[model samples]
Target: MASYDLPRRLVAEAFGTATLVATVVGSGIMATSLTADTGLALLGNTLATGAMLVVLITVLGPVSGAHFNPAVSLVFAMSRSLPKRDFGGYVLAQTVGGVAGTIAAHLMFALPLLEVSTKVRTGGAQWFSEGLATFGLVAVILAGIRFEQKAVPWLVGLYITAAYWFTASTSFANPAVALARSLTDTFSGIRPIDLFGFWLAEISGAVAALLLFTWLLQPGTSSTLSSEAKL
Candidate 1:
């Protein structure tokens, strides 16, 4: 339903992803600089990331569906909302954009250009948290698009804000984001060694959500039921 062509859509995906990650990494850096308390720093990071999602999705949804997350894109493709042919381009754009965002954040704070994160975010609990978080994210998107399309941006923003506190992995449900965060050694970073588990968890969660929600929101059954009731 998007009016933009492939090239424009790719640019929107790249630019939106870049800004989203920049907001995330930049805000985390600023939060750490200003606070000694981890709670307060996390609060700042959460608010900024949530706010950016609202803005980005609102502005770019029409052009590219505002899929800054590879998991989200994959789910869309699976649902046929996004063409399978375009899935690879979306993932590539999101990945490169996320990395660029991290670079931008580091340069803004005068930090090293690229530092492999040493933040060890491994273990079963963390991996499970990421899976659950990503599951909720995709579920929200599917339900919101079906029922409250206009409110999708706000729904996502609010969900992530809460997920940050509830999830152990801080809800880095996006594989592109997780990979980019590995380049930063700040409050939001995750070690590169821990990335595989995150990617697996997120993709699994997304696919599960897609299948479940598709069944729940069965388009054919709904209309058929309505017609039978009318008769």
Candidate 2:
């Protein structure tokens, strides 16, 4: 990941985000078309999304850390894992790529290039769910990096698979993703009006997780000293 240049990394971020959003929006459309039962439709959407995450993360993580979500990128930037200078570029790439993904999905399904989502998804419960979902996501990511770097893709994929069922908002925990979803009126879409609430909750939760995990994952002074003594 470190060996890649900034331009290459940015391209990877954009491409990865585009593919992720395409999978999300595309799967939703396919699922809804296949099933009348809401639960069955959601199940189909969830499986495709989770599976795509694993594939994208595994393939692109080495290029750009595969941060398709702005909230995840925010956490990495704050932690200095991703440079602050590149944060804006990352967000821009992700947002643009996400919208492109929505458009691509629409093209595949013979829908309009862009349609404002009308599905209502706002209010206190939904906001809280978004917050909790993002918090858990960031925590899982940081912990995976610390303890099991190779398993991050599966960890994220599985977590989101579970979150889709458990969360009221179906865990649309990424700000970039939320914005992209607003452009499509489909099974996965959230109303454009609801994006702000989701974004606020997601960013807040990500920062909160970063704060707690930074302290929690840090080595204690005593432990450091003891290790040095052994050395």
Candidate 3:
């Protein structure tokens, strides 16, 4: 990978993450505090997240790939698309942005941190949801890199949107994101107790995506890949 401007990448990562977090927190608060139906709140929040994600990726991708989620970074790191030394910076910037986003969400609602709980899935459902969510997210990301390099933002947004509506866990496929989202106990909050289960499932799904992506991208490996591998 060519040298990435650390400052530029950091700024991009921070801003991208911040944008993501802000949307989650802001939308979550709205859903929790205002919406009468829990389902509506979830739908509204995720839809906003999906919209914001697409826009941010389009805007920041040119600068930092708009990897708002660490899993995207991890997959790229595995593929040697990102420098190892920069991973820490990327993660840190993302975390800061997440915190900032959560904080922004809190501030927008004028609520305490304790009130930022997100009411995420738990138990067997949480585990399975994490797996499916991660699988879907990683699949989209890897596919984008391997084939549809041009329409990544739109495709990703569509995937997330559909995942939120179709999947049981509402498709939070990111580990750092899961952790960051957990800090609050609001519409976006996941119980800290359930964190490990979700993370493990998400990791498993991401690894699966890496393997599938590798198999699909390798030439003459049609036996292991799929036509969906096309961008």
Task: Please tell me which model should have the higher lDDT, number 2 or number 3.
Answer: 2
User: Model 1, 1-231: lDDT tens per residue?
Assistant: 467899999999999999999999999999999999999999999999999999999999999999999999999898788999999999999999999999999999999988999999999999999999999999999999999999999999999999999999999999999999999999999999999999999999999999899888876677889999999
Task: List candidate 1 stretches off by more than 4 Å.
Answer: 219-231
> Can you tell me which runs of candidate 3 are displaced by over 4 Å?
1-4, 113-120, 221-231
Q: Can you write out model 2's per-residue Cα lDDT over 1-231, one digit (the tens) per residue?
A: 789999999999999889999999999999999989999999999999999999999999999999999999999998899999999999999999999999999999999999999999999999999999999999999999999999999999999999999999999999999999999999999998899999999999999999999999987799889999999
Candidate 1 positional error at 72, Å: 0.6
How close to the true structure is residue 10 of candidate 1, measured as C-alpha lDDT? 93
The lDDT per prediction is 0.95, 0.95, 0.80
Per-residue lDDT over 117-223 for candidate 3, one digit per residue giving the tens place of the 0 to 100 score = 44646878768877888887888877886788878999888898888877777888877777778888777778777778887898788888888878876779565
TM-score, ranked from best to worst: 2, 1, 3
